[model samples]
Target: MGLEADDSSSPGETVMVVMDANRSRGNVHAIEWALRHVARRGHTVLVLGLLCEIGKRASCFPFHMGEKLERLGEGEVDPTELEEEIARKRDEYKSCLQPFYRHCKKNEVKLESKIAAGLCPRKVTVDEAQSCNTCWIILDSHLKKDKTYIYAHVCCNLALVKGKDVVTLMPSKVILQKSSLKHRRVDDALLSNEPITDDQEEKSITPPPKTCCWYPLAWRTGFPRYFTQSELEVITSGFSEENIVQTQDNVKVYQGQFQETPVLVNCFSQNDERFWSMLRILSRVRHRNILNIVGYCFTGSSMFLLFDFPFMGTLEINLQNDDLAEKILWKARWYIAVEIGACLRYLHEQCVDGLIVHLSVCSSNVIYPLGGSAMLANFMTAKCLKDGSPGDNQSLTHCLNLQEDDGIAIDVHDYGIFLLELITGRSARCSLDPDKEDLIDWALPAIEKGSLSEVRDPRLTDTTDDRLIHHMAQAALLCLQDLNRRISMSEVLAVVRGHEIARPGC
Candidate 1:
């Protein structure tokens, strides 16, 4: 069993306790005693039971018998029977753990249980211990071969419990100091119910002190600051609907104030693996054109990413409103387009690690901050091109050569659509006319034929500069080229800038 003491005086330090479902009653009793002791100290317990003998399937099958059975339609294994076997094994483990569950409930201990199948108990236990951030491990002294391996590999305090009362302590050298002997002796006394002297009692009542290196590590690391669950709850006002700004797929964006500064909170459900991966990516990336992560929270299974709130909201909202669209003058529109292009270029070429593709680069995902340049948001769908991970909605055709610049060509395609929307003042997916629902299909031909006047927004014709309109249309056309012939962002930026310079101006 693995047990962790929180470095802080906080009560919620997670303690991982590894147990074998098939262990002897004596070993089980000793582990139970250790769990109760830790639970009373205000640490949460995570019990992981190894199912060593279950889930073994035959490696080899007789070809002739298998063929005969397949031909007769009677050789196939029943799925129901396979499920029943798994259920039976799970039930057996659950039954053995019933007493521990009842004990935790009786003592009001925060406890969780998991069953894992593996032949190597040491490897399984070590992996679980590391993942759970275990501060301590309690093992049965009967463990012979795996004991030394677990001791050397697991980065935590180790203890071996034999019979009813024998406990051997091996503290982690990296975490404990020579002075820790006093703390160890005090812990032993507490476990043995020995009367404590005045000095020892005073030490015990004091808050558990944080180690020296903890502060430096947290300060130097460029990782997002970890916020506690309580802080998040208070900031989001218990995640009430009134605080919600937007919802994308399973993620909810809530508006909250942090230290009197407005912030946007992106909450992801426990089951979303993307949340963890995105955190890693966000830590490494910081750019003026990309929305930055202010902080993050990991409480149990749920995750929340805090970002600087975009007070002006999304580009889509502006595009759909006539008054807002008027405020976005020719220069502002051109600036927005150029800024978004720069953002994509930075993601693809300038990131420290490797190329990143913002798969969902549509109008809705582009945010216009109150006093800043337009920036890209919603990186949940973003992927590092170096990893060759496909975007959520990308097809086989679109994902071709993702490690190369061509892999980001699909994003170029989407950006082209954004340009078309900017020029025509039409939604990419919807339009007032049913016949013109898809902007690309309806406008691409006109745009390619240099018929800028025909596809330009009627609302923009009188107010926008004619030269700027023609230049943006031409650039959008270049971005919408055939997949094999599409222009790069560098080239598109050059063309757009060339037009701006060539126009008559002071």
Candidate 2:
């Protein structure tokens, strides 16, 4: 679901976490709460470590430290020695937070750290929070001593995590909300110091998969809402004709408003069957590049679903409009390729509940948000490996997992078609002319013949990056290979990003 305007949850917001890098003690609970609850895709978690002033010498600072050191009867500290100390301090900070780096990167959220020397924790935390313009700040109760001062002076939402299961949120000046959850047991799988992949290792990212308590596939506090029938009507302006933006597969889509933000309202009949199926899959999935359901309404003989309307409209819209077409340059198209591949990877491998098959993936179904990253939407034909929750129906889950599945092949193949469209600009041109040859028919031969230049979009001939194009074509060809030898989305994503994986050559 898209974030609400005035809500604490929104895209591109920062969550500032104040922790003392000295001891790893009270930070586990506070950081765990921030990542598991408050942070998600399109957000950044900044870990600010404000060093205490306990034995710090004036000679440790930059300028004139040499004079002070000389006056103290010792020569100036070696520049190399100072650098080593800073580096060790940074490594200490990274080790304390290393276990969670895998979680943030996997979810597509940015995880960053800063080291600051300060005299007081309160002043340092407030100054950093203000500068970062963060949406919320979670403090390790052990590190912050002056809670009353922080609560009054901090500019954004503040949370004081006192223990493993308790969090006190200062949502407003007049109200303080406290919530408790089951005692968290950190999974070893998530905390492993496994070596990172080559590309991300320099940044101290852990590449392996991490999950918490089965990733909370079951209904939780942050899941989409169930809007009443009246609520849907008010948002859609009583099904006004002018608001009708599209009609597809017997459903009417209306442009509407919810929480002062634009949204798409989809109306379906009671017996459509697709509604329940879509709801089941969409409810269980969340990714930065996958369009999510914000709210849904089911009443009487009609059903409705709400989605965050892309600020830039569908991919087809952007590619066809003359003014917008120029914006989808080769770089953007390459970015779109990587993003959609990652989105498919999440749906295919990361959903612990069950495998999801998005039956419809095309230019029309792809949305372009303001950030220009493509989001896969329109899951009316989507399905989960199990029809119901695994907790309630374990047999079904086991059965689906044990069988030979074609859903992955189908999605991978569709993604290959998408990559072709990206390079050739076939989707846009084909939409305008009904008689154009199928995208595969038009480009597959050139790709097979190793004539990539023949298939590149005319609009990008001068600006295209040959290296990325080659990698994209390689990944696409891998995807469009014999279904029996089809590649996985993770492999596809790696290739698109110019990584060479021993594929059985995928």
Candidate 2: tens digits of C-alpha lDDT, residues 195-237: 4332431111121222221111111223378888888788889
Q: Candidate 1 has what TM-score?
A: 0.51
TM-score of each: 0.51, 0.58
Tens digits of per-residue lDDT for model 1 on 1-506?
Answer: 22343242235555665566555332564456456444554566765555454334211111111122111212234445533443554566556666777777776666665555434576567766766657667776555334445654555666566445555455553444335654565344324422323111011111123343211111122325888878888888998899998897989989887666577788999757677657656766755466767788877678888887777788888888998887777766766777788778877876646688887888888886544467788887777666444444411223223556565787887888888878877777685468655788778889777787778776664653666666677677667756667456766665555433221111
Cα RMSD (Å) per model?
Answer: 21.6, 17.9
How many residue pairs clash (N, CA or C atoms closer than 3 angstroms) in each of the candidate models, in the order given? 6, 1
Candidate 1 wrongly placed segments (more than 4 Å) = 1-224, 387-403, 431-435, 462-464, 499-506
The Cα error of candidate 2 at residue 78, in Å, is 48
Which candidate ranks first by TM-score, i.e. highest?
A: 2
Screening candidate 2 with a backbone cut-off below 3 angstroms (N, C-alpha, C), the clashing residue pairs are 503-506
- Total clashes for model 1: 6
